[model samples]
Target: MEFLIAPIIVALLASALALTISILDKHVNNYGDVEININKGKKVLDVKGGDKLLTTLSSEGVFLPSGCGGRGSCGACKCKISTDIGPVLPTEKPYLSIEEINNNTRLACQIKVKKNLDVYIPEELFNAREFSGIVEEINDLTYDIKEVIVSIGDESIDFVSGRYIQLVVPPYGKIKESTQRAYSISSKPSERNKVAMLIRLVPDGIATTWVHKYMKVGDKLRLIGPFGEFEKSDCESVMICIAGGSGMAPFKSIFHDMLEKGEIDREVWYFFGARTTKDLFLLKEFQEMEKKWPNFHFIPALSDCSPDENWDGEQGLITDVLDKYLKSKITPSKHKEGFLCGSPGMIGACINVLNDNGIKDIFYDNFA
Candidate 1:
């Protein structure tokens, strides 16, 4: 009788708490539709409130530049806010600079669509669109690297020569959600109906392993945009491009564009680095181009050259080779711009070398 009475008392208390929570949620969680004004009301969207601004804008066919979808991690979806949406959250603070914060910049993925909000976005982002294509070809450049050529029908892939595209990888194996990986477009910009991407196999990587093992040549693909601002500058500076692994993608596109437009006489020095002789590719193509275009110089270097290979070219670490070229081969007074693409460690090291050599205007394809 005592045990029965105690059980009854606990059940009654639990029921009362559940009822109170239900009542509170009914009133507290309901937020009606909100209006979003973009670029001073030039574009407006009336979307359901309480969702993140990044998702709401994407639903309205307005694709904002977000690398991690709406996860609030990439910090690529920064937008200027005219009206006070809310105080800046902790998630967005690390990404935003002091100047950006003063300019009222906020991460769209973190800001919830609560009421009428005025946001300013870049005009160029409005031009970026989704592209559906079929993988026409996959050519192996190295044992771990493959080049995927996509045919986009009549849809144009209008982009600057050095910009990158996001590959939308569908869920595979245990990956429950799709993810987007950025790859620099290795194809020529003059060929508007086709896109080429160079991908390297990463160990147990979600996207790379799927591409290497699962993706077929004729499979359909959904990709987005020509993101990043790493294109060649218009200044009359000598171009010094350094790339290793799949980082060779964007520079290939740029050089082709230069050749097609007869702008090959730009005094360019392309340094391609690899661990061994077998890791090197595109030597014959670039060497042929070097013969055709007097201004283009192809410099292929190997860090671990075998004795049997008898490599006569630059044989040292890429940074050491670059340092040698800067001091002895390249003119010291000429204004030079450094183009680097690789992992963060490689890029940072290259930046330091370029800065040390007085090549101040350096650029890299930082595709987040």
Candidate 2:
């Protein structure tokens, strides 16, 4: 009977503590109203406090790019905070560099708005807008990849070539709340009225599952514009662009924008990688670009191509092929910059290869 009484006492204590904490959260945590200073007085907002900074800003129509929809998972909603809120959180430390942390950079989704705060926002983000678009078409790029084209009827979006947009996925089945995911735009900037992106299916992923299973050609979707700073540099260095699978989106936009702007004279070598022939797509389109543009070279490599197939292209892992070309075909003295997009693991591997080959000034965008 003593053991039973001890367990009951412990349970009662736990319940009392939970009740006390809940009551305190209801009364003491009500931080009524707060002022948000943006860009040193470019824009100011008065909002109800006690919400995450990301949600509060979105409520005021100043949407920051949040790839995880205020879940604190994606580090995309970072901003410089001038006012003292608190130290950096463990959730944000993985995303923030030492320099960023030292400079008061914090993730908006992780910070609660408890007082008046000053923050810095880019001028370009001020121009970003939410767009409602109809799905024009959906084509199978590969077994696992699908090309989605969205048309904003009579509306136009102006953005740089290598940028991304947040795709708003509505709740379905078990998902009760909406979420946003970022995908690089594959369409050229000239196609102002349309947005195209390549999405690869990820197992049990919220946005990808919606796009793959629930979306149809006539479905209407909401998109947030033209976020990201992954544009091509203006220097005359030889461009070494590497990508795999759906990573081809931004480069497709960049290359076509270059072609339209008559900037194809700059030397470019695009190295695309896949596991097998079935995983490859957009071969003919890029090959045609190579034929018309004298300085553009397209090299698609397969890592696990079977011996029975009559494949003549570069065969090996992408990093190995890149090292071979860097050592043999390309001139070592020519200045070069590496542009990469892929999964984080692939990007890490490619960066190691590029650094080993004496190439620096690398720029990359990795999908989460």
Candidate 3:
């Protein structure tokens, strides 16, 4: 009789607690209108409070660089805050260095807009705008990679060669809201009316899955762009570019721009890494470009080449091959600029090699 009564009492307590929490949350989260000061009153926005800073700024046509789409995972949407929003969250600490923390850099996605605040973002982001485009074609470059060509229609994009555009992925199935992912533009800057990007399928990647499976030619999609600072420097330094998989996009744009503008005199040694012959692509095209443009050299290295592959090229890890070239093939007299695009591990490894070999001018896209 006591056991039954106790069980009923426990259930009643749990229900009462849940009801209290639901009531508290309603009032606690209800923050009203807030003012956002950008670059110290350069631009001000009136946004509804209680939303994350990233989404709030975005609502006002000011898109900050956000790779993970306000999940507070990517840590890309960083902005310096002059006002005291709060203490640094544990989620943001991993991405922010000690110096950055001291400088008041906060992840915009994590900060709740409880009150008026002042934030500073890069000046270039001011010009960035959302553009709608129709998918012109989806050309298969490899089994896992596809070149997505998009026609911007009446809108034209003015961007540098090595820059990228954020692809706006609409909600599909279980995905509740739209999200954005950045991909480097593979098309040359001369084709401002349209754009092409090399997209490689990533396991469980939301945007990649949508592109490979659900998307079709002529499907209209929205994208925001002309972002990123990775571009060719004005200096006539010899560029040593390295790429793996769909990392080939930006380099393709950069090289074409160079070739078209008769900047071929600025020597380039492009090292492309692949696992087998199957992974190697755009071979004939780049080879022909090399032959026509004397200053351009294409060195496609094949790592883990099987016997049946019948491949004869630079064999070994890409960094190892790079070491050999830096020592013997590539001239030391020319000021070298390293352009690397691949996995973060590969980029870090290559950066070490480049640093060891005295190539300091390194450029890379963060979204990679």
Candidate 4:
């Protein structure tokens, strides 16, 4: 009787272990295949279901501009869906507007690929690429601004003149998850294998502080880019650009591209505002470029120049300097376009100045 009981117990234990193994396998490795139908018929991708839509699409080499890298915070990964994936998630609610929700738009990061999905994306996004790069050099462009040069590994990036890239910062000590931040490409478009960005250190900003304090030479980072439409148009109109602090990044790219391509036919006036001489940068480069491009003019304005600094230029607030220039230097009769980039406050002020001067075709990029 004892021998028969022992055999029965052994069989029961083996059955229990087999049941547990099957349950674990089902939970861990049972993601079924799913199909994503894009634009009804433009393209179709078959991928494993159960991952976030952003990650799955990115893995398939379909890059989407995401400032938070699919954490559902930046709300940059938004697309329209023809089929229902699931209800609107709480993480996506804050970023979606009422009109967006009504139009069947959803956050790609929040949606899970549980089943087959039909989604629509902008055609331009198909050109976006992700690149891995090593930090070549980091130089202080200004007191609080650092210019970082990243050398692309085996792949190269082809981006527009004034577009921006999202830099990926890995998790640090207190940071539980990685984060992404967008910075305009300061390097010329001709340098396809190397990208440069001018980053301003914001007091407690997660990414900026990391770049300023923790990041070192030769650190590896990933970047996803070529996003934004802040380029110079082909119209034969005067270009009036205004920027503050690190807002100089995009303008540098645009100006250099214009010089290299010999597209300096239209008159260009660049106004860079700073509190003092210490806050200013790239003056020598701009001066050299000004000599090269006869029609291009670079203006550096100091809002509060100390007497001891021997500063000599337009003074007062940036908007005030811009208003004076519009009234005195630039002619209102000629067709003009205003290009502005800066903090939200400075952009708003410059917009008002441009509007008051009858410059109707104003385009701007503000960092809010």
Candidate 5:
């Protein structure tokens, strides 16, 4: 009798605890329907509240650029809120400057949409789409650079020449969280259903390391893309473009698109830099393109060429070569535009060179 009574009492206590938890969840965790007004009634989203704005918008098929997958670390998910949700969060403070906070900018991942809110986004973001793709081919273009081709699953992506896509990498080992990294699309825009990237292996880089060591051909991948404002403008200007290493991706797309569109009225000088000959790829293809487009020039330079490798092209640091060319071979006019892609250091150096050469209409994308 004593044992039976004790078991009954324990069961009653367990039931009571479960009931209490359920009641608390229903009251505290539940968020009712919320309304989102975007861009002065350009669109409205009726969603269940309690989730972050980023997740809610994504669920509604409005994909925002987020490098850390809504973790609030990358600071890419910024949106201007017209309606106040709450005070700024600690996670967002680091990324937001005083000007941004003053402008009522908030991290979408950290802001819970618990009520009717107004948010402002760039008009171009409406065109951004998520794509499901399968890795079709992975070829080593150089010793350190791998060319990856992804075939779109159902639909095609319409993007400009110098735009990029964010590849989603799932959590592995110590990462503990999934991440997304942006890579410029290397394939021409004419290849609507296919996208390619020139990936350089970065030692210990979270995404590159995974791609080099674990990722396999034929694996399914997801990406959100066609984001960025890097592209050619309609101006009768001489284009001076500079890149290094994996920076070749966007230029490849730009050049191919130019060739396809027959936009040879503008002169283009593409300067590609590498540490050695082993780091170079696609020279032959660019050479062929040069023949087809007389106004376009492909210049590849090696900074540290080994004795065994026979390299007769430009030699030295890329910036130095660019400075020499800008000062001597090319005369920059006000209409000249500079396009640059590479490491942050290379981009900065190239920018200085361009600015010194009186080329002010410069646009660049740096992968850091």
Candidate 6:
């Protein structure tokens, strides 16, 4: 009991010290107004200093893509700071490449706005806005995957298919602060007043927990979006799209948008992988799509499916199925491009398979 008490006292002291530092930083360290020059004068913000760059920008109506809600975990809130804001922090090193470090790219969430700074961001970010939405629908795509639809009354968002939006989860239960997470818009771009996201529950994940457990119909929500550069090419090359689980979101939007716009001339082969039939979703939806769009094909494979189950689709690792199709099923004469979205390991495996099939051009979004 005495040993446990010693550790408890140490933890208490550490917590007190942390709280004291936070209060001192918040109340004592006032850096006054700081000017943020964005995109070489395309936009300028005069904000209170001594706050995180991300919070400062958001308060000024500038929203950067922060999958972890400015917690310095997602590393998605990266921007080029041409001015010297000090060296890259240790928390940011794991996410940034050496080239990015050399270019002075820094995580906005980890940087403190101590003074005037020049930052370069994509012009499209200027169009991203915070939207007020009400939960309209929530359907379980699978045991783990959910289709969440939000209705944005009156106001509409204009975004290309395959882009993602950040869903803001307000504080609830034991959580003391709100958080935002990025989710690809599965709804078609033409449905401007509604947004749908396929969310896969991650154990103990702040945003996913709130989405799966706390979110309910008629609940008000905030979404900041139109971020991400994932989109279909206008070229005529056959598109070989591959995904697993919630990775299907972007492709769903892209295909629906293409179909709606009468751009089905391009051939597309979508390969969806899962461990079992129970893990798969949208079989009927994609099957109907395949029937309606002759040029589109949907191949769902299960690697570890039980023999007792009535499974008749491809059975093997996703890479193996992809390779098999590339060798025999797909036309060798036609130029092909690969679009992948999934875990880093899955994306790397698919890339190798695609490259071995004499395909070089590849684009991917890694859910890391």
TM-score per model over all chains: 0.88, 0.92, 0.91, 0.85, 0.86, 0.94
On residues 222-330, what C-alpha lDDT tens digit does candidate 1 reach at each position? 8888777778888778999999989899999999898988886689999888989888888898999998789898888999988899788889888888988989999
Q: What is the C-alpha RMSD of each candidate to the true structure, in Å?
A: 7.6, 4.8, 5.8, 11.1, 9.3, 2.5
Off by over 4 Å in 2: 1-28
lDDT at 263, model 1: 87
Error of 2 at 223 (Å): 0.6
Report the Cα lDDT for residue 117, model 4.
91
In model 4, the runs with Cα more than 4 Å from the true position are: 1-32, 71-73, 85-99
What is the C-alpha lDDT profile of model 3 across 50-73, one tens digit per residue?
777888888889988776767777
Clashing pairs in model 1? none
lDDT by residue for model 2 over 158-272, one digit each (tens)? Answer: 9999999999999898999898999999999999999999999999999999999999999999999779999899999999999999999999999999998999889999999
**TM-score: which candidate is best?**
6
Arranged by TM-score with the best first, the candidates are 6, 2, 3, 1, 5, 4
Off by over 4 Å in 6: 1-20
lDDT to native, each model:
0.86, 0.93, 0.88, 0.88, 0.88, 0.93
Q: What's the C-alpha lDDT at position 255 in model 2?
A: 97
Model 1, position 308: C-alpha lDDT score? 95
Query: What is candidate 4's CA lDDT for residue 119?
Result: 93
Instruction: Return the clash pairs for model 6, or none.
Output: none
- TM-score of predicted structure 6: 0.94
* TM-score of predicted structure 1: 0.88
Model 3 spans with C-alpha error above 4 angstroms: 1-28, 366-368
Model 3 root-mean-square deviation: 5.8
